[model samples]
Target chain A: MTSLAGLIDRLEDAVAHRTPLEKEHVQAVFFLFPLMFFIVGFILMPVLGTLYDAFMRDVIFLEKEFIFFTNFRYLFSDPGFWNAVRFTLLFVLISVPLELAIGLMIALVMNETIPMRGLLRACVLIPWAIPAAVSGRVFELIYNYSYGAANWLLRVLHITTEPVNWLGSEIGAFIAVVAADAWKTTPFAAIILLAGLSAISEDLYNQARIDRAGFMTRFFKITLPLLKPVLVVTLLFRTIQALRVFDVIYVLTGGGPGGATEAVSNFAYKYFTAGDFGYGSAASVLLFVIALLLSLFYVKASRFGEA
Target chain B: MRGPDLHTIRRRVSGRLLILLCLPMLFACGRGDAETDLVFAVGGAPSELAAWEKVVRKFEADSGISVRLLRQPANSQQQLQGLMVAMKSKQQNPDVFLMDVAWVGLFSAAGWLVPLDNLDRTPFFGELLNRTDVYDGRLMAAPVYLDGGILYYRTDLLEKAGMTRPPETWRELAESAKKVQEQMRPENPGFFGFVWQGAQYEGLVVNFLEFAGASGGIQLQDETGGVRVALKANLKALRFMRDLIWEYEISPPSTYTEMQEEEVRTFFQSGNAMYERNWPYAWTLHQSDGSPVKGKVGIAPLPAPEGEKGVSTLGGYHIGVSKYSDRKADAKKFAAYVTSKEAQRMVVLELGWNPGRGDLYEDEALLERYPHFGEFKDIFRKARPRPVIPYYIQVSNVLQTYISGALARNRSPESALEHAQIEIDSLEQRYGRNPEGGGGQLSESFPYPSFTHGEAVP
Candidate 1:
């Protein structure tokens, strides 16, 4: 016990001899240690564990054996895996642009000097505020074949003689899911872009107007160029999110109509739930690689932070 | 030195604060005393769960053992997934599992379940008890309730169509449904001839099994040495199901999208269809006060193919004790209690569950309360179980995919079954050989005892 007390005294003397600023730096690091430990333990460890599992052959009720690269090789050959990849790309390609365009439009409108601007901005966020699962259910009800509001409006408008099965066909289900996702996420993108819009000086717009610039010209020149950084960030985030879409499609179609809407995440989720951890982990690793590559491309293309 | 300055004091205090902050986590890391409370994972409708709560209360009072109920997801597939995760992790809290009938082979082969070979089986129906509980000459689970697929038709519509009884064959049923549809269309313009679960899910597998059984077809035929996929019977069943939608135009195209039993029930209960193939639960729902077809529905055996006996797919929950359970004795007692005739009677009287025991079906009071209980008992005795193999989930998933593909016109029934057979064969090769004595070998066909139908009650 006396030796332990002497060891503590020596540690204190070593710390006391350092400069006050350095001592403060040491204390700051000590404060962050617990948080760093949490991230490493919970998040990083599980990620590494998944990566390690990807190299094995594991199925429930069977012994796990190390078969490096075999899972990936099998996945590459599986038709279902390729189908999921194709649909995931299609979903991301369609939803991201639609979300960006609508989000920018809403953000521009909210940037205007209008009455009840705060209320309007808050109201625009309501759809985004609803949980994705709940919104998926709402969309499910709205797209019901017999009693949905979509068919009701169409009939009231005399658009068709019969109610359309919005969620029963492949193309119809795809379009319906994408529309639901876009509706749920556009407001979030709008809020982000709105912050960017607020950051731009009002004087710049005034100068553009004085220079005889029209609305479209000023938006193209000033607004677009200034919002590029924020837009790129939003695109990167949404692209990653859209690539991993599961809940809405699951609640909406369950990847049905002959697996037309099966995303990569859904495929991996199915395998994972079926206790094929090795293959599921392999699929997830591939997804992570794709997401990482896309993020790198965005950062390189935008080049926003360099300056 | 300024006699241990403020900087030294601040550093020591900060270090003490950090240690204090971690104290709760340290305490949390300590494992508590050996758990005495038994956890049972169960899934059912809200009303059924409420009735189960009363039964549990009684058991707790009688045994002095505390029980915690872990409600599982309503979807069967999701519930199985949850159980698999828990069992794979070897969780000791959930001492008992309310498993689906199809899960017996999978859970037992995984070594997640405790063998209940010593339990008395005399009170239960011989066939029902044997088919769901036994796996590879050992009992792994006990029957808690019995559910079988039955045909429900609009009694008033059948009467209007000059049919005094339900159809006895598939062709006759289609003709009757068409006649009823033709008569009822003017009054209810959106009327459909027939509706059932045709989606790509576990329900679709059950639906197909009934059809295949009635046609004297089997998907997996367990022979003396190995298992073989019955491709021809499966193809025929798929063709018949597809024809019901496209060739006959009796069922709607929307059948491909229906995911749960509730969807078909909703359509039938709304008075939109003349015939619906569903379980006995729909009978109670149909007779409920809010239903449009209240007291207008009749239950009957599903129509068989010509010259064949009609068979329903056996469906229900089974109770099993988890191998990882700490309180095995208490868990076993609870399992036995739930399957006991007394508790089963309460289940039937209060929750409308068909009792697992055969004698309870003959009880005068139960028959009086649920007039259709006798019919259900007969259906239960005749119902055939799905393939009892450890790889049943994989087999069912393949069938659901291919059968729905055929129904959706994406592939011909021959091609779909061909693909399904290949997939199932691979599964059998991987898991069916019973390596390591996991007891997954399908070495013989299930012994299905035949029982003569009793006289119908007036």
Candidate 2:
């Protein structure tokens, strides 16, 4: 038979035994739980709200109804909605490739042993640092027919005799918006690609040079394959930023010289401000779904896992 | 290994309590503690802010109520969008709102404004009864100083262009623009003949309305207190504007995209524009001591096109009490003081507002303070308020968007006008009329169409 002390000792053993320290595991959970909650609260909440609002009837101020795909039906039926979607898609398709190419070229240039690399790096950031609203306002002046720098420069180059009201004409406005958006976002893409370029081991390039591999061959084979992951990340980030483009388009011509530049976000903002919370939410949902689909397609095409 | 649990339990308890306690503290933070402090709201423009801040100081001193004035920033759509955001706060929407006259119909229709007709029984009520404040025969809000658009021309430049007086017709104005462009701005290639608000917003509607009326297009006409839209006249006027930008190239293409009265003023002040179509505030600011255009400017009536009538868009704001205001009695006192004859004089003499009362403009002393007062004040008297229907805001947005698209997107003007007329008809049906419907109509001279049947267009 055990004594009273012995029984107390056993009880204390049951109560006082502690698990080993899991600093890494605890640290991971501490960081992850908050990040998980933030994703759910800020990003997911709005996204879910947008989805529900998309399908419901817009009964201003009342508890909205579940109309079972009516809003989507309306969205599909509207020409304006389709116009915005088509324009937005074309914009993404045109801009993404051009922006990506330019970004890579810029990254290559900056990565070289060139003089004034620091100045060039800082200069590259200038376009990205400018707020879209300010950029839009500034470019509007730059694109103005009478006073704008574009026409002045064009005149100097002897491109056209007459002033091109870049924002006044439909095609001019389209190209102008595309050019402006690309200029601002290319810097972001370049910075991302530059980071990827810097991470590459010097030994690999040296080995390739010893093997007498040409610059293009080396770039296409080793560098391209290795940079695939970073390129994917840059594409994902820039596409999302460009997909929901508003500030520049809104400020420049307000989706004018006749809605030529009305992105989905601009359309969403109009309804949102007009007190049509439901319609606005529906437009937002459409944007979200399109962005999601595009992201999924790009992620698959880029072979994120395989690469 | 054995570890301390008691401290852990204590920390856990405190953390849980802290989380629970945070919510009520947040709720408390949201509510106001100062019962005596009054917050006043106003839209910002240099002329108006200077005037309003002075009024705030004087009101706080006399009434012994501490007034906190918050000025709304100036940006297209985004600035106005901020006001809608502040409305979500149960504590914030100002006690006394400086409501834009254009938004008076909209905010009231949404039941955002507290009906002040029943709120007041003051001597100023008589004048209030006659104005646009009483929508559907309910006194929706109170009037502050009034605003109206007029032409600001370079007087010296006009005389130099061989025009002895202001152009009385659109043709003459265009001729004046061409003559002035040749005379003064030939060496300076960036200059424009005229600068006006042409963005797809309310200002565009107002600016377009003035041009339409001047071109013999009446946007709205009331016959026996019932309204009918004279769509043809409006179409003609819009076509003229389309021509003004496209064919004549008098008003720059940027005008088709510029959103506010201030932008026109900016271009004018820079000497980039020969004439500007803007509100009375710009005219006042130009005459101020520091103005670059102070001694260089002149005022004139917006000329008619062909054999049409001289008309300008009625532009200004109304000072209204919010529905959710806790201190209704105190707010009424402030409103009374603002719309009073003496207060109007203060605004006119100090800030250059064309007060709602017609008599204030006739005061010689007030006229002395504003040298160009005689012409702009004369222009204000002839100005017309926009279609006061609540749905007009929605309808106008459609009209302006399509019109802008036509000019910007290269769509036809005729089709855009036709589309607009049809859309407006549908919007008009949603409005509820007063018991004495069609009670008061301006004479048949104003000829905008009536929304007889609210039906969708093809």
Candidate 3:
């Protein structure tokens, strides 16, 4: 009877010990549940579904059939697909660095103790704040062949007698796209790099000044190296975003002049809009793979820079 | 380690957060299944939408059926995308909608449209009804309006050049344009000989078809949907189109890059072009009070190739009931009322639109209002439609690229058509109903491409 009573007492003690601990764990899980649900439901599931769809003949009005790698095979053979890839890659290679360079310059300008700095920052963000579609239309007007600002300026400056066909020729369209994209995205890069720029210790700069380091010397030695990590992150972010570009191109060019300016995402969207989901999914999956590889490369390079 | 009050507050906060997170899902799932009002979707310029709204109100008053007017974007492609989204998910709203004629093939094949067996299709243009709305031996939609490409010539410019009438052929048009452009250029530097839809969009395809002319024009071969774009007639048409931009220097360089119907019309209306190729709707706008060429504009059938008869491309909107619609009866009632002769007459009178109904063209009242209606009757009858296949959008996307490339002088006409043929062959193989029957080679005939689920393919 005494032993049985002792066992009952021990059981009560165990319950007392475990209840709060278990409660805490359960509460923690509850806190995380919403985030996990969103991640799984929206992002992970659609990505997996798209991956699965890439292997199927998922066209409208047709029986959905598993046609493994066939869509990808077709994509590889498609010249339009290759053109899109070439355009996207070239765009990234040119525009990303151009944005970073311009952004860094803007960040440095904003970092200085200049008058109306806050107002200047806000004004700079206006282009970035506007939706891409709206800004694309604005750029469309700016680049209009006949009476647009682009031509008006060129004529005023005596750059050419005739209006340069901005969205007509292949190279002209390419430059227009890059310039428009750079204008829209450079502010985002500037804001991020400004954060990095500010994070630098004032003491280091003071020491550099004491050591009589010139502006160029200080910028090369201190600013650039310190800004490297942030630059890599910004590069990865911009590259992924640029690879999936659709809205600006859709509004500005409609992938025109014989589709000289069509991006991979725009190409995929065409298929999706056409109800050829399998081919569209395959295109998206290829783009996704490209982005994944590029991000991975950026990650490795960042880690190397950190070391 | 927290006190009981703190723990309770944390739990309450988390509970509220969870509810907040679930709120969107709850609202998203709150679809009204017992909806009685028929949702009729139509898109156009604001004025056009307002006219449609009036039609819907009249439809409600006439049929005692309530319809919810769902306004769509003015851009046709954006409207198609929105409709595609709803149809893809099999949504019950948007019970009825206006479909671009080209989309009829895609929508019908996808089984998104309810077959209108009871619709009195005799009222609509018979050939158009068959070309655009019929699929699998059933009428899938009813026409709402008819649009066809026509030539808009500057009468004053022609009169100034001492040309009594508009050019009858491409050669004659060019000769007249060159003669007038030379005379007019010193005074008006912006003036050009011709303006057309040379931009890389659907209009380019329509213009190309018109240029190909009625004889041996580029068309879908059959239900199998094979197309021979590299045919001799198509080649000649493409070369002439390119020469107008680069060789003859008649059409502006921007024509290949920027011109669509609106751009072409505005350019011509602004007195920059001697001749313009555009749809019939532009006639009213060109003749509006403020237009520079208001009184000087004249209409004619689009000029054909030297030997072939000129034919405009068939374009219009068709209204159909959705297969997924819960209110199919109401939807059909509204559709019928909208396409009825009375409503068509209202559309013509109120909006200055071309009526889809065949009988409206014969109406004495409409004839008095729009004398061009007589000319339009002939153009509408002779109009050739774009390829009527499920994959036409995809096919157009391919052709838009190659043809625009050719016009931009990036490649020769021969190479452009050859490559386009190759690309289209593969598109057929991928999306064609019978892959084995329709791939690689451009053929003259293919049995109508029909979709049957899981029966044929291995």
Candidate 4:
């Protein structure tokens, strides 16, 4: 009976010790206030401000009043707004896949043993390293109908009979923008895949080779299955980038050749820069929503990268 | 010259290095950080910047104000954002800023500029320039050196083509260009027809307006003055531009959507263009020895369409004190000083800018010093403002959009103009204008590039 009581007492003591202490967590609480303020002030406040501004009646920032989604309601009828969305989606859908394919090819090349491979990897980064605006202007020069090196080279090589207007036609300008973007950004994907490739074991490839596997057989059986997480991660990163594509399109076309290249960002810029704060905010919020939805869809469609 | 030891040689070398280090300070470039600092911004190639640098030095010497010239975009939206940011940051360093005349209207409406009426204490800012800066009777931005569009032609090319005088009509111009371009010199594809700014902006409106004016189409009829029809003329003028690209093929169709100033000038300077429509700045820059057409270049009024009056709209940067500026007094002083007779003389003569004052143009002494003033003063008198409305930007945007479509996208000029008129009515309605300002009107003073319903005469 005493032994049983002693055991009960020990168990009761254990429960008593298990109870959490009531000591002040001063450090965490103290740091948390400013952090919360920062998040609210910088992030939440601007987001809400954009949302609030979108519904304003007048374009004049201070003069505006709550018109309650009149901007969006008007936006549905606006051809310019629709044109921007359609073109922006087209830019994303086309540019993203091309970039991914080009990126994967380059990544595969970099994965192979080659002379000065480190130097070659860095060289590939040169295009990606330059600022987007700078690259945009550079591409503008490249695509200039007159005195553009692109046409000059083509003419020199006898590839075409006449100087093709890269920016003159709607589809041509669209393709020019996509090509410039792909050229600027493919290295980002390459580097991501390179990291993924580095993690991939050569021993698995050796075993597959010993099993008399063909190139495709080895790739599908070994490399692709292992690299799925990294591939999805690289793809997600590229898609997010592709969705907000703006500067290159802006510098290349200025949404010209009759609004052929107008992106959501360009539309937002035209309004915001013109001080049409309300309309600009509506366009910007719409852009943000589109980007968010696309990102969420991509992350989900990649099956949380577990596939 | 004693044979120096290593120590002596090192000391001499160090002394020379010190002199080189102090050279900038000695030149006074380093001395004036806080001295009467003023910020003036302009946009152009580097050579143009050199002209403003001279203007700044003169201002510094005359007024004892240390000048900080901020060279940024002349017409970019970044300029507006930059000004707003500076105002918010409370930076008073740049005392004076440059603003385009059209931008002045928008900026003035925002009440961002100090009323020039308040600057009455200064003798430099006369009432005439100040009065024009006002919006709704409240004074804002002041006109600095103004700009008006002009046509530049290759004298040699025109003479070679046996057209003794420049074309006075669009048809004559196109006919002459087609003749000149077909007889391309054996060595080069010399003398293309024409070039002008055509991207969707204020520049395009000017091009559209000039043609419309020259075409005998009228926009706002001085109902009292008998057939006030400027906008209609503006559209007729635009159709001429369309015909030039699509019908004549004399003008570079590729340039219909180009928004560059220098690109057009380059073709003219390279002696590949017979006639080019550009601002006076192009004339100033093209007169240099580097231009193949320098000695043979001719500055003439733009061709009027079919016996109509030639009209050129005023284009320029204006100086204004910010309403939000704490240093409003200093800002007003700087504005007036820059526009003063003496400063005007220096600016015109040295910087190749046209002076706002007419008297200076005739001032024999000033003309003796600067000869171009005598030449351009006649042109300056004819400078007209675009339909000076608060919603002028909206008007121009619609006009430019339609014109670009008509010219570049191959839309018929008539269809484009008709579509533009409908768009203008809708835009005006959105602005809460009562269609015709409630005059039971035939038309709502549509400030678009004017066109006519009448068929093009064969």
**Which structure is stronger by DockQ: 3 or 4?**
3
Residue range B1-458, candidate 4, lDDT tens digits: 32334344334433443454456667696454444455665554365477667767877787676666777665455776676565544555455677767666566655566776644324322443543466777657666677777888888888767888888777778888887888773555434688877765557777777777666554322333122222445456666787776678777756755646677888778877888988888876788877677788888888886756676767777777765554667667777776677767766766767666656767887777657666666666666666544455555656666677777764667667766665555544444454354332224343434345443321
Off by over 4 Å in 2: A1-18, A21-37, A52-74, A113-122, A152-163, A198-211, A304-307, B1-35, B118-131, B160-162, B183-186, B216-230, B258-260, B270-273, B288-296, B421-458
lDDT of 3: 0.84
| Interface DockQ per candidate | 0.32, 0.28, 0.34, 0.09
How many clashes show up per model?
0, 14, 5, 19
The DockQ-derived docking category for candidate 1 is acceptable
Top candidate on lDDT is 3
- Model 1: share of true interface contacts reproduced: 0.28
lDDT of 2 by residue, B296-339 (tens): 88777788867776788776677777666677667767877777
Show pairs that collide, candidate 1: none
Measured against the true structure, the TM-scores of the candidates, in listed sequence, are: 0.88, 0.83, 0.90, 0.81
Candidate 3 Cα deviation (angstroms), residue B152: 0.3
Compute the lDDT of residue A145 as modeled in candidate 2: 63
Off by over 4 Å in 4: A1-45, A57-62, A159-161, A203-207, A304-307, B1-71, B87-96, B118-132, B217-235, B257-259, B369-375, B418-431, B434-458
Question: What is the lDDT ranking, best to worst?
Answer: 3, 1, 2, 4
| Model 3 chain B: lowest-lDDT 10 consecutive positions | B449-458
Inter-residue clash pairs, candidate 3: B223-B447, B223-B448, B223-B449, B224-B447, B224-B449
Ranked by TM-score, top first: 3, 1, 2, 4
